[model samples]
Structures are given as structure tokens and as C-alpha cells.
Target chain A: MTAVRVIAALALFIPHAALAGEPIGQIKTQTGTVFVERAGASKPVAIGDRVFESDTIVTTSGTVGITFTDNSMMSLGPMSRLKLDQFKFDATTHNGVFNSSLQKGTLSVKSGNIVRQTPEAMHIRTPAALLGVRGTEFVVRADDAS
Target chain B: MTRLRLIAPLASALALSACCGPKDLIVVLPGADGHVGGVIVETGGSKLVLDKAYAGARPGSGASEPVDVSAYEVERVFAKALAARPIPPKTYTLYFVSGGDEIVPESRAELDAMLAEIGDRKAVEVVVTGHTDTMGSSSDNDRLSLERARSVEAQLKDTLAAKGVQSDSVTAVGRGERELLVKTADQTADPRNRRVEITVR
Candidate 1:
């Protein structure tokens, strides 16, 4: 635990440039195994790890939760591959766009300020169809059997 | 008569299923300042616009019809997101007295409000940027601005700690006269420019 704390402290000091991209959110919770693929390189996702746009998150045997800058939350269940396709928000105006694609498995989303400011700003895509959120919570699950 | 009885039961079952509804994607919004405007759910080239509470299925999905969810259900589905949600970044401006780090009396209320808002959050990130009017030498303004930012940061940190709020990060920077809130000629004393801007997230 001490070592983890040390790493978390050090992480705060790491220049943003070292992270190699614009951070859209951070991993909030992880149970079991989770990996993120960015720039063609895959790495294990830690609790405080930053997630950037275009990053693909795959959970092999557990669940992972991520919170975006807009305070939106996305949780992925086991055997899920979720992509942060696009995220853009204006801090001042609190208006932005949220778009993601769920390749497989179960995922849940809670809308944030971006949707609050304009309800039509969010879009989620699955192999079966595209989803547009109106201002409430919901869940989706996709499997090959369906 | 036997066939009619069987069809009646089947019809009732279908009605019950419709009432239960199909599971649609949920998008929970904030309930602080009243209901958010609404959301649009689109599928298979068709769109369903939900402006009130909840939307169950996409239009033309042939599954369940879209309907409004109660405020109670909205809160329930959004519980997790609400708990993990971060306080949005907000900027508070406090004007300074003439040439010193001391804030103007009128700005104290703004400072207090900012502190109160910060106290409500469990975790926060603060950025205090100090600015100066185009008065005196650039070097002097630079130092004074930084001093002002430090002052605000110190007070903010103390208040937040008292409220059991953890400050993830606190940054103070002095913009000097480079970025003026109001455009002014050199040596012009503008109270609006001589201010500290505190942003809390």
C-alpha cells in the first residue's frame, strides 16, 4: 500500500507531455483484469491511470469503471471491449460531445454535463445498432448468441 | 368459448410485458438545478428524443415503447454515477485592494461562496491564478500577483481541510500584467484586472 501511494504521488508530478496524449478520463475502479491499448501498445490499467481519446479498453475477466472529465461514468463488464471514440467538452460552456463504441459485452453509462447542457450530444454505438441517450441512466448488453 | 379464454390470457401477458418495458441505454443527468433538458436516442436511422425523465427503447426497435421515467427511478439508476461524479470546474474572482494582496471588502462574499462550494466536495483540484492591473513595473506586478495567489490558496486549503475535503492538487500562478481581465494603458489602475481567479474542480 505504501508503494502504491508513492507511485500515485509520483504520478501527479509527471509532466502531462510524458503521458503522450490528451487525457479524457481516469480509471476509477477495477476488479480482476483490465488492459488498455493506446497507440498500438497495450498496458495494464491501474486505478489512477489516465485514459485518452481513441483508447480501447478490454476487460478479460473483471469489471472496470472510468470517469471522464465531464463527470460521465462508464462501466464495462467482463469480456468487454469498449472504445472511447470521441470526447470533446468546453469547460466554460459545459457543452460537448460524447461518443463511444461497445464491441461486445455489457456496459452502463451515466450522462454528465455534456448531456445536461444539450441532451442530444451523446451517442453510443454497438454492432447491432446506435443508441442516443435522453437524460437518464440505462444499460446495454451484446453477445454473439443474440 | 375455450379458444376465447386462451386468447384473453395471452393478450394480458403481452400487455404486462409492454408495461415492464425493454431495457434501453440509460443516460443519467444531474438533478441539482432541476431536470436537464433531455436526450436523443437513435437507432437504425430513426431517432427518439427524450426531454423529460427516461427513455426505454429506441424508436422503431419494435421492442418497447419510449416513456418518461419517474424522478425516483432517475435518482436510483444514477446513484453510482452521482457518487463518483466530480465537482465541475468553477471559477471565482476576487478583486484586490489597490496594490496589495489584501482583497477588497466587497470581494469577501465571493471568496466565502467559493469556499462553501469547495467544502461541499469530497475531492477537489484548485488552480489560483493571480492577475494585476497595468500598474507599476512589470517585475513588481509579477511578484505582487504571485503573492495574491498564494494568499488565496492558503486560505482555501485550510478551509477545505477543515471540512474533511481532500485537495488532490492546488496550483498558484501569477500572470502579472500579461493577461489583463480588462484592457488598459500602462500605469492604469483597473480594479477588475487586479484580482485573483480561483478555479475549483
Candidate 2:
């Protein structure tokens, strides 16, 4: 009974650890300065930095572009704060979901196979409105200044 | 009330992000006053012109009440700022022979075209997916499809490395006969159904 319990515990723990280590995307380009906040720690964003779900990317005076696992690309302009809220893709079927929030500033996105497989799979949220990506490319800007 | 408003946006943001639909394009243009005057959002045969500041929108759903963007400013500065950003993603598809990982002879030219497209980019990431016809069992097709995808991925990595272009990541997946391009009955061998898709960014 004890051995079985330990085995079950290990089985549950292993997959969670693997999933947590899976990188959702990578920072392909960064000009000027960008930072990523993950798990409460903030670090400078550099070229080739892996981005994960729940990571918040803040760009102060430069632009940063990230290409996700599903081949979707997102470029953030200066003074932007974006978060990868959720991303799930089945590479084989090219079916997945992508959700992100743009707190402020400008963002341009080009949908990948996931969106081509199903249009509703991509969604971007701005401070004032929700932009459901139904097209191959679109630009969004969220301004909170009053 | 302030907190409630903030929470609502957050919750709705999550909700809105969960849905999927077909592709649509939206072009936002500002008025002479520097405020977002209207937007041209289109999908398929439908086109909508939204003149308000805020709007609840989705592709193919036509339009909803305008959302509040009173604080938003659509200026040339913002447009120019984004225009200077990085290159967009590029994708190419090449078909393969039935039940094999080999590319069809006719599609051999596409590999060069694909490589040429990524040759000039400073940064790159590649993803390859393989598919197969339904002639084989599911498990066998899965392995064959994966093998096809891996073959393309390996070639892409080798070519890029030989050129000294460092790819951030090269990932591949075999989807078996699940996502058929030509939707055929089981045991039917369709040439189009066997293919590999490569996406570079």
C-alpha cells in the first residue's frame, strides 16, 4: 500500500513538472529595452529568451517581438505591457487557443495555424475592448491615459 | 465601483480570449482630431464601419455596442512606432509521398523557396507538422507522420546552421491522418492528404 501511494504521487508530480517547464514562445527580437516578469521575478528581456504562460512583458522604450509555439507572432511597441494569459496548441492538428492582454501601448499580431484552423482560437484584450482575431494580421493599441 | 469595473474588464478579457473563429481584418484610422474616428473591420464577404470610440467586436458576428475608448488616442506616433517593429511570421507547405516521409518531386523546388525566404531574417524559429493519408492504422500513421515532420525539421536546422543562422527553436509534430487536407474515407490514399507544413518566424 505504501509503495503504491508513492508511485501514484510520483506519477502526478512528474507531468506537472514537465508542463511547467514547457516554454510557450521565445523573444525573437528586442530593441532598446524590455523586461519580463515571471513568477514574481522581473528580468531584462534579451534575444532568445523563452517566454511562458503567465509571463508579463513590459517594454519601456523599445519594441519586442515574440514567436509562439504555434507560429503566431506578436510585436509590442514601446510603453506596452502585455501578458500571456493562456496558450495551448496541439502541434499535430494545429488546433489551439491563444489569449493575451495588452494593458497599454501598441501591439501587432499575425495569426498562425491555430487561427487558420479555427478563427476563434486567438483573442487579445485591451483595457477598453476585446479584439477577437479573425484575420491574419491586425494592430491594437490600448491607451489608459485620461 | 472602480474595482468592479476593473474586474469586469479582466474577467471579460479572459472570456473573450477563450473563443475561436475564422480570420478577419480590422483597419483603425484616426480622425483629424487625433482621436480614433472609425474602423474598417472585415471578414469574408461582410464589412463593417464602426464610427464610435468603443465597440464589442468579433469576426463574422457583425457588430455590437461600441466599447469605451475615451482615453485611447490613435495618433501617427503610435502607428509609426509599431511600423518599425520586427518582421512577421512566414509559413510554407510542401506535400509528401503517400506512406513515406519523402517530399514529392514536384514540391522539391518549394524547399529552396522556403529557405530563401528565411535566409535574410536575423531571427528565426521553425515549426514543422507532418500529416498522412488514412490508408494505414492510426498508430502507424502517427509514427510515419512524425517521422516526416522530423525529417523536414532536421533539414531546416542543418541548412540554417550551415548558413550560420541560429534558429531559436525547431519543433516538429506528426498529426497522423487526423487533419486530412482532402477529407477522404478510411483506407483511401490521397496524395494531397500527405504533406508537411513549415512555419518560420
Candidate 3:
């Protein structure tokens, strides 16, 4: 939604539903009609479903909670859309990157090892904002429904 | 009671703005321990730093200044999303006898708490890493550590399966004397260093 950056991030996460990357996280909770779109195909999500890079999460009057490999957590609210643009972690060193974009609705995040090991490693994008996390819990709401 | 009633309208206005006013609103929240960090919000050419608990900003307006938000406003606006947060990952340590693979009786129950937590999530992924004190030969320590790890793994693998926790991701590894929790001279025995760590996600 922040136009350039968000659009760019979404572009990377969409269409490639078939280009499934390795599991970067897992769905810890799912309620109602949450769907995951991968490589241009959409499927309903389950509690233990693995989330990968380039995957788009769509919540149609539903909610979802995900925990990343580095222990980062994110929750999406009803009528929300989010994309896992990319994620990489080196368990040995606890260094990693996490990038995601929120197109609409609400998201709550708790930063974990990736951000704690490398403070600039995690970022969340929105229609009008690009957020750089510094090891904290935060929330964001986007009204533009694209 | 009368004064509280008088302040109700102002609270309503805050809730309204919090729910429907900004095109994009970012709020920094305190951690479970009440520690607030910071978030840098970047717009076209401006940036705002929200560094306080309940501090809010609107990126659409390119506002560098943070607006103080009440906890009530945040709860009213973001109750659903906040409620959906996943539990944090956790690590548990099980100590071992310095000379043998026998686990100290007290730390054998590290997995019991984890077992109760597994039901809340779809599955549990476990990594059990074994370590040893430096009092033995490298190969012996390696074997001892691995045996220690296997014993713990045996306790978990079947118990979790019997409980229908749906986890085939349980694994064990031995670090021998390579990764000591407390660094010490060679051939020294330290109870603290002789341990196994279980991580659950």
C-alpha cells in the first residue's frame, strides 16, 4: 500500500505460488476462512501448515497466527492480507532476515532472534509506511484494501 | 462516578480515531515484561521513530512526532489481531551426572511442561542437543553425550506420539566437550556444563 515499496514486495510474493521456497515459519493458529496463495494457487490454511517465502496470506473474515523459525511471531486480523516476501536464518549464528508486507487490515508482531541478533534484519511494509523493527512488539493497521 | 461519566465522551472520540481515522497507523507496544523498544517508520522522504509503549504514528501523513495512545484505544481497535498472536518459542535445559549418562533426577521433567503446551499448537518441533563436561576422552564424551541425548529423545518421541501431538520432527545431537556452557580447563568436571538443551517451537 505504501505504493512503490509495498507493491514491489507484493509482486515478489504473488504469482509465484508454485515457486515454493523452504518453510520459513509455521501457522500456529487459524480461525475461519484463512487462505494461503502460492504459485498462483490458493488453499485453505491449517494450524500446522508451513509458510514459505513468496506466500501470500489472505484472511477473509478470519485470523491467523504464525511463528517463524527464529521465534518471531505475527498475527493477522480479519479481512487482512500479508505476504512473506523473504526469510533466511542461520541457526548456528542466530542471524537472519525477515520481510513482510501488509496490504490491508491489522497485524501484530513480536520480534525474535532474527531481529535481536541483527536489529535491522526484520521489516514490515504497509501502504504508506515501511517499518524497521528494533526487537519489540508492535501493531499496524492499513485501511487501503487493494 | 459522576466524574467518570463526564470523561466517557472523550474516550469515545479517541477510540473512533484509533479505529477509523488513519490510512495507516503504526503503534509500538511494550513487551510482556513491559519493555518498549522502537520502530522506525519511513515514508517517501520522512521518517518517524516510535519508541514508547502505546506511541502511535501515521505514515501517510509523514509525521515524525508520535501521538500518545491509551491502552484502552489500542485494545478497542486491535483486539482481534492481538488475540491471535502465537506463543513464543522456548528452551529447556536438562542436566546430567558429570561422569555417566544418567540424568540428574531433578531435571528429568523438562518435557512435561512442554507436553502440556503442545496441545495448544498444531505440532511441536524439538531439537535436543547434548553436551558434556571435560573430564573424559573426546570419543567417550561424544558417546556419553549422544547416549544422554538418546535417552531424552526416547522419552519424548514415544510420549508425544502416544499423546497424539503430531510431531515427527524430534531429533537429538551430541556436542561432546566442544560446546561447554561454562568454559574451564581441560579435564575439569563441571556439573553446569554437563547438560542437554531442549528447544521447542
Candidate 3 residue-wise lDDT, A105-127, digit = tens: 99999998788788868999888
lDDT of 1 by residue, B1-201 (tens): 999999999999999778754333434344455655554556666665555444444333464446655657645543433343334467789876665667888889988888787776544556688888888999988888888888877877777667664555566777688778889999998878888888765
Instruction: Judge the docking of candidate 2 as incorrect, acceptable, medium or high.
Output: acceptable
DockQ of 1: 0.18
Docking class of 1: incorrect
**Best candidate per TM-score, number?**
3
Query: Candidate 1: lDDT of B122?
Result: 40
Candidates by DockQ, descending order: 3, 2, 1
Report the lDDT tens digits of candidate 3 across residue range B1-201.
998997999899889877766567888998997877789988887878888898888776545688888899789878999988877777788876655556677876765766766665565677677788898798888888878887888877778787675554676777688778899999997889888888777
Task: By lDDT, rank the candidates, best first.
Answer: 3, 2, 1
Q: How does chain A of candidate 2 score by TM-score against the true chain A?
A: 0.86
How many residue pairs collide in each prediction? Answer: 5, 14, 7
Candidate 1 residue-wise lDDT at A9:
84
TM-score against truth, every candidate: 0.54, 0.68, 0.77
Higher-scoring candidate on lDDT, 1 or 3 = 3
For residues B1-201, write the lDDT of model 2, one tens digit per residue.
999999999998888756543222233433224444344443344545555433323344355433333324334435544554556666678976654557778787887777887776765676687888899799999999888888877767778677665654677889899888888999998878888887666
Candidate achieving higher DockQ, 2 or 3: 3
Displacement of residue A82 (Cα, Å) in model 1 is: 2.6
Native contacts kept (model 1): 0.20
